[model samples]
Target: MGTQQTTQDKYYVVVAGDTLSGIASRFRTTVKQLQIWNNISDPNIIKVGQRLLVAKATAGEPQPGDPSFVPFPGGEWFKTLPTSPIIEMMGLRLVEEGCGAAYGFSGPGPKWNDKHRQAYACFQSALGYSGSDADGWPGRKSWDQLRVPFPEEGCDAQ
Candidate 1:
């Protein structure tokens, strides 16, 4: 009889502060595959001492630099907006033309009135402005601030 060759599966012990994405990258496998193999419903929920089965590389698998799997450099430097196309579309308009324009829909303002100023403050807060709201209306400093990850060109989108 001929001798048979056996391949043993490799396993990894999960450590504290280990994330599924981090572990999957280290093992050269996709998070989806690891989840499927181990019947994990939530990739984000992993515990220390969990045993992970490392799968062998497969054909047509995504490479490290593949667009879908690639880690964006400086990604952490920017914040992602919540998904709401309607909000994005409308919010962009409000940001562009809502409060800061001359006689815009945000309320007629050479300088905003109390109500107008309150609305402006809310808008500023929504846009992630971190400065004091005591002054209400956005000033030179507010315009210089990078709030919603988009250009704060004077609202003219009307």
Candidate 2:
């Protein structure tokens, strides 16, 4: 299909697989600015057919090399702890403890062992649980009782 043009002022067309970040980067703007211009309440809800109004270029526009185009990860929450590390640690401990066979690790290797320990540490930090580095291995309590911050809606917009 041919490129779609914006009629209401200068706007950018949302393409397939296009994220607000990617679009902002291309146009030397920010995701926040795009959201504000388009009255976009939901940053994640932009569709392929929506037109995003970029700011009108004026004489005082930001220079090309300026750091004005970085796209923010505009989710409802800040970066929380990642869950993969916790899961990996649990799986690794199961293998090391002879409770289950490890899927990705082949035989006894230092890399796998180190990875398991790292995962355990991450899991501890995420759950706000504390333990000695040497003694902290994946446990049922750590894995099962991990709590993540949920996105709270209807709060005042920042």
Candidate 3:
């Protein structure tokens, strides 16, 4: 019955005797997820005092159309687009939603490709969309639902 030590309910600090599986079990997540979130290539190497993201960041008080929020670039935009940091953010969101399989070994790179569409389709399916609606296109509804954060600094995508 060891209590879990966390910060802001988002991160967990590793303590002596802590194991990745134990932490994942306590957090109701998977070890693979812990590895992915923390970028830990070796699950056995977590050290004491190490901080790890155990939960997704909540939207909190931020609302749509906020200056720091990313707006939908229209469904067609995902089709004809070349590359944008926004797309990378979208793919990251999709992967966060359990659609990482779409990217496979390549991952969600900063490119608009079939992998992006496949991941978007998984996201749309997760939202209960089907058929043409979930045809892997980034519609306004799904785009907003994805809740892509504002692009990182130095990224030119809107």
lDDT of 2: 0.45
Best by TM-score: 3
Q: How displaced is residue 17 in candidate 3, in Å?
A: 24
lDDT of 2 by residue, 32-64 (tens): 567778898876778998888874544443333
| lDDT (tens digit, per residue) of candidate 3 on 1-158 | 22223334488899999988677646644566689889999977899999998755544543334344477877677777659888887787676667879798878988899998888888788778999998998887777656676666745654
**TM accuracy, model 1:** 0.33
- How high is the CA lDDT of each candidate model? 0.46, 0.45, 0.73
- List where candidate 1 sits over 4 angstroms from the true fold: 1-6, 56-158
Worst 10 residues of 1 by lDDT: 70-79
* Runs off by more than 4 Å, candidate 3: 1-62
Instruction: Name the top lDDT candidate.
Output: 3
Give the RMSD in angstroms, all C-alphas superposed, for model 2.
Answer: 17.2
- State each candidate's clash count: 2, 0, 0
Candidate 3 TM-score versus the reference:
0.59
RMSD of each: 17.4, 17.2, 8.0
